[model samples]
Target: MNKALFLGLALSLLPIGCRTSNPSTTTSTGRITTGQRNQQAQPFAKGADIGWLPQMEASGYVFYNDQGVRQDCFQILKDHGINTIRLRTWVNPSSDSISGHCSKDETVAMAVRARKWGMRVMIDFHYSDSWADPGKQKKPAAWEGHDFPKLLTDVYEYTFEVMTALKAKGVTPEWVQVGNETPGGMIYPEGSTANWAQLAQLINKGYDAIKAVSPQSKVILHLDQGNNRERFRTWFDNARSHGAHYDVIGLSYYPYWLPGNPDYQLSIDDLARNMNELVERYGKEVMVVEVGGEDTKPQNTYDMLVAVQRRVKAVPNNKGLGVIYWEPEGARSWSKYPLSAWGNDGKPTKALDAFLAE
Candidate 1:
């Protein structure tokens, strides 16, 4: 979006129609015109973004840290061509009864690292303690029973607080996910209502707060079970039918989790087909927010991911923006924390390969 990019794009669009009796058709730079180049240019950036949860300080797992460190991981990921970092945030998620690894401060640091190293940032607000997905959408402890109106206030305050903190740290993210994988909905009775009207208001509450702090940042609404066409249809229809305002639609495609009637392979194909249909259906940019082939396998840790990325990228309309592998290079050393994410293996698993185009 810079002046140079603009000139490059404009100059690349010149027409050399009918070759005007020219000895050769190639441009001075020998590059095809914009129209011709775009067939393969794929101007829109492509590649899986990378993010990380700091080693859960003595939670349980022994992470693969260099010299007993964490930030080193970022440098390593950058070396591998990752240009985006998606960080998650939780609300009152941990206490003596628990401990959360992804705090607002952690997000600030991660975003700073990403931006410092020339990577874009996607700040994901889980609005819950642990994973926020379709099967489970738990209300944050802070909004345990607050009435609808009060819940709305909580959403705004929390969002603004995080955004402000990040901004003060000079780490404004390029994208912000209002809520993480809120397939069913967000917040609970107030924000998690099935009523489109209520969903819109709840989403807007968070959206308003985000814009107030960082108007330039793009807003994202995320959902899990990426392959579920009906689920997506209902969710998007409701979010849109109501007044919910969002710019990007985020999805998590875990082929193993979403089971279909026909068979596994059939389900994968159906998932891709479903995504394409939704892109055309909604006319919105899509990001495979979270995806990974299980690293439990010994052969390659994870291989299906490459195939999955291909399935999405092959779709028309450039709807398939990018992919992000969740915990691909997990800090195995941090597994000791009761709620730690990955299993103990003392090594970054095969999932990393999937992000690097395998």
Candidate 2:
């Protein structure tokens, strides 16, 4: 079966509170503080995509520290050594409980909070009102029925608008993904990989828009299945042939969600191999922008995370940027996501301790 089909099946089975009164050190011009500006040069990016956070908080899902004391969610994550926050933006998302409400406004607010917490930020553009992944890339409802040319304009304008909004709030993302897990492509038929030329055009529009607003931000083109070398080679080769512009290759690694739920040991080597090959082949930096293991198995998850980090760090000359857990704090009790690194007691699992390693 194709990767997209497997992803569809996998999904069919699947399902910060700390008030900081500290005035943000960010300049009124919306630029990061000098100290944060310097930290942007760090070689690795340890991150978590808390796109579901606002909703979780509004739903009254409280977070606690390892001591079991109620704490702000951001504090809990920072305590576990998380240094970056990834937020997903939807053009005009609804207020749905599980799969909605990451609108640009919400995203900007989240980015501001992340920066205030002294964490680097990554913005992921789903370009849809809801989830866009390997199996689906539905366009925002407003963009429906548009012609190819109009679609290109939509991509560029939407991207620019979001980037501009984030900038207005003094949150310059350190990294931006044009699309989320777009192995087949994004925005459906017009932007689908079925036509590499069109797909490249759509991707370039988002890329150009990002550079226009945040020239220093490293733009990432993301896809799922980090361990599948053939998938990367084929898709990226087509992208290169069609002149898709991007600064980095982003991948998602989820051993637990693979077709057969393989152990991380079985695929960690392949992920490393693919990352090294990507750097060698395209001369582009690579990052595991998304990763997770079974939250119930803390020790095993911890070991897998350490090994994954070791492999990424092993890449010569730091071409291997780093790994980002998808949503380590999205506790299963609240989100029904089995892959998070948080426990039922509202504390981070030992799995997140891997980041503290080395």
Candidate 3:
């Protein structure tokens, strides 16, 4: 569900090994040397989609350490073991208080800040002026009335421009999500799943633009409901059949938001199964790119977070890249979002401690 909608309705990678200068280069304790570690691919990403951080700060939201001392939000997140920061960018967004202001400029600035804090970055392109999720993927206002041909150009140009801006700042995102929670598709009638062909073209354009700017960045096609295998299969099957290009299958798994507000236990195993199956079925890496729990239930949310991370790490052959907590720092007082990991006292909830575990 879109965050904006929730406020209105009710409120809602890598691998190791390969190519070492000297495979036998080991330290005195038999641990691999720094060179070997550097050569090896990145570890599982413990990410936080802090898209609302800027807005939160702008609105005078301050964070506190466990001891109640004032602290930088990034430092608080880092203290909780988050290694990657994910940001969402909206095109031509308004300056509205809650539902806007994720413009390209803001995204680039945030990416640079994350890099300064030694956190890798992931850029999510909503391609809309505001929120883009399972419920609504409205096209940017500037793109209104454009034909399919022009829409393709819009996606490519907008994506390329944003990627280029990030590159100019020397902050290449490790992963780039072309669309946000687009199970039904993005950009509206033209790019909707109702017409797979047009949707594929739009997606490919975004992919091409990202690669053009940062060839190393992995492109992700995201969808909601990580526990529903049928939904994933049906969507990805159409994506594959229509020649949509992406390197990763991104999923959102919010047990709290499920139809019945089911317990995480009811759906955790299914979420793991779906992730593994998606990797096998699509030959692409998988990631639980968006996840959250009820801020009010700190213990339950904590346990669920741990379980989610364990399932992601259990993916076969390390194809499971990681689990990211969406807006973990977006405290309820500021965002009125119930799924955040921050307590109303301005301190992080115990749920974020899950990232500290192996």
Candidate 4:
């Protein structure tokens, strides 16, 4: 799911002797060394992507509803050197209307809009009626009582429906996620167990759907709290044990949320270390699919993202694909108590200059 999730990655960064399917080789200094490196670190920004879709807009701004801002915003982002648009699809959002949450049609429209303006598109599937995140994983209304087999069938149908439509429209997705932040597992209890065989079936259903419809698209199995090396090791070990298939391993990194002492803040050094460990441990390609920081002056949160990126790029086995700000531009929370808070600009918040600067 787009809202539900979350990198250290490179394939070939491991030892030439002992081989894993997706190995990440490392140097003595701990900086990532790999033939599959995306780009070398430099002051200039390269190989990164940006976007502001309604579901995953780094800001979650409501300007999208206005139609005017929505149109202009797309152009504005493109004008600023942005080359991609990412949209999230919530399976059968409660209202069925594009205005209420996100839908397949709305995402296609957004993709059409972006394509018309020359930007590539990546569609995310949350497989739920509402948001899918580490904290809450809601099942879609249509798949209420479905068993694992039925659920997998629904996954294929729904995914095929969306991708098939996109292909016919000449706006096929450049990338598609099988499920959102599937840390606890996707489609709920059935495939939600720590069991890999069951979970792998769900993931494969999604992967198969994409390949059947959009063969060119890359599929991802995104996870959250990427900084925790052990958790990632455990998750991927389980996923592989279960036979899950995916092209990229997307991760969510929020330094503020990382566990530690009373402070628990992440320094640039910490970011580099954790991300580098990812490549050495998982070998799967990694992308910081979802990221965010608060909007205080000095761009406190934005600084963290910049630092994190810089550090990741500096890692010994760095592949440093890129990072995406998860709704950093969001307006306010969408819940009663207000939980839709990845990005908000109500207060005089700092702009995203920091992330852009470096």
Candidate 5:
């Protein structure tokens, strides 16, 4: 959902074997080579939120390479310099079948695929059967009547189960988001920002669950209105005061919606400024975890991405991890997303070239 609009109202891979054996190039004996090792050593994330790919593909959407040949959707992103994949999971969304595909099993399958492709995975737990965001964080059906304490337990148990399932499949997410976009807090009144203490406790439970199963996995506290410095400071400050622990701060930015939104109106440059300030203030790695632009103006989108990349990389001490294009695959058959980076041909538009930016 486009939160800025609502708030204003009221509110890869490799080459063939022609190769020579260079000593610096460690042999790939079922182990990562030296170059691959160095790439992993770099402390930055170039990612994409591809949670829609599986469903879209299942619905007959096809992705193609630049040459117009059929290609694996994930391969396309990997070819374009994306090193991380972000998938969102819901808690028993099956009651509403349309939303259920991103259930625990489905998300694990996607994560396994990503790991097989040598990409880092980020699990975004929406904590709801359907969409959960700053505007609405409806509790899952099973937890609707639970009090704050039980809700906390629910979060922990669900997180642990998901993590355990992923581990059993050899898919350990490098990062886990406790909630989708919780600017107003999650699970409605009981865990809303109005009750910061309970909200913090709930988040901590999810955090603890993640650590229990995968200590190396980083926990992210995500909120929308990426350009709104005041909102971020207020939310994070409240969370920290209530003892909420997290490893990364994730933000969502969309230029098309931010220009005139009363709640968060900031240009690209303004976003960069806010990001730098956020990194300096929090001393935590920051990621523009969600970003998109108008699909009609592919070139403009490309330029905007370049600008974002430069700004993020400019963060002092490289604390700015990366920028993720949210659902750039929602083009052509999935015209619902006007910000998709795919063209009518079912191939990525030129805008995706921005990922190649240095």
Candidate 6:
């Protein structure tokens, strides 16, 4: 089966700144506290996409620390050396009456919680009501019959609205992904990669929207099959040719899925090689936006993460942002994700220790 088809059969899967402020205060000790204190940039992002936290918690799931004491999931992750949290937002998810639990409001709430714990945030926009990947990029219910121009407009308006809402809540995302796993492009026939012009236009519109609302936020263009260097070159080269502006190249790397084809199989070393090549070729930062390992072999997961971290950190000038586990929090009865790092005990296994290994 084709990769897209296989993905489909895998059971449906599943912004920054405005400058206008100057306020200073003086401490009672006669110390001048300037509002313009220079902020130190985060060293690197070690992140997790705990988008399922809300739903899982709703189902009475509770996370625990290494000592087995129940704790807030975000806190547990932070204690384990995670410094960033990624959340996915759907256009109009229908899985739940409350907008599928991954709606804009829900995502913002999660981001707020993550921020409170000093974790950076990355918002991924799926532009669809449900799962979207290389296999499917169905338009949202409200955007179904729109022409290409109107779809482009919708993408911009939606992106701007989300960013504006996030800013209102004092949650400016460090990174914003235009689309999720868009190897074949997004939004079906309208914005598919086969029609590079339209896809590029849509992507550019998302980039412009992010800049308009939060100038400091970096925009990322994400795609799957991270081990395939040729695909990255082809898609990005075409996107650039058509004016798709972006700061980061995000990739999803699942060793099992990526090396399925006999003609194009790639090892972890191949993935590292591709990461270096992508940085050199594009002069842009690269991140393993999503990666996971088998729940059956926790050690394998640890090794995989360690290798990925080394590869990313090896990039010259620190262009490699970091790695993010897709949904490592899906411990028992909460998720069917096979690559989760959680064991049956409802807590993270040894696989999670890799984050601390750094």
Candidate 4 TM-score over all chains jointly:
0.73
lDDT, candidate 1, 1-358, per-residue tens: 0112222333232221000000111222212234432433232322333333343323333344323344455565655455677778877544321234467776677678777877777788877765465545577876787877887788889999999999998876767898877766766655664555777777888888877888666678888777778988888888767767765678776654443423235556766877788778866556777764434542333455666677768767565667776654443232211111233545444445455553
Clashing pairs in 5: 7-11
Tens-place lDDT digits, model 2, residues 228-278: 999999999998888888877998888887778888999999999999999
Pick out the ten consecutive residues of candidate 4 with the lowest summed lDDT: 12-21
- Candidate 3 per-residue C-alpha lDDT over 192-229 given as tens digits, one digit per residue, 9 for 90 to 100: 99999999999999988987777767788999989999
Pairs in clash, predicted candidate 2 = 16-73, 17-73, 18-72, 30-170
List clash counts for every candidate, in order: 11, 4, 1, 31, 1, 3
Residue 347 miss distance in model 5 (angstroms): 0.9
Clashing pairs in 3: 6-11
- Assess each prediction's global lDDT (C-alpha) against the native: 0.59, 0.80, 0.83, 0.58, 0.76, 0.77
User: What TM-score does each of the candidates earn?
Assistant: 0.75, 0.89, 0.91, 0.73, 0.86, 0.87
Question: Where does candidate 5 stray beyond 4 Å?
Answer: 1-43, 95-98, 259-266
For lDDT, the strongest prediction is 3
Clashes of 1: 11
Model 3: which ten-residue window has the lowest total lDDT? 13-22
TM-score of 5: 0.86
Candidate 1, overall lDDT? 0.59
Compute the lDDT of residue 53 as modeled in candidate 3: 80
Ranking by lDDT: 3, 2, 6, 5, 1, 4
**Model 1 regions lying over 4 Å from their true place:** 1-52, 57-71, 95-99, 129-131, 259-264, 298-301, 331-345
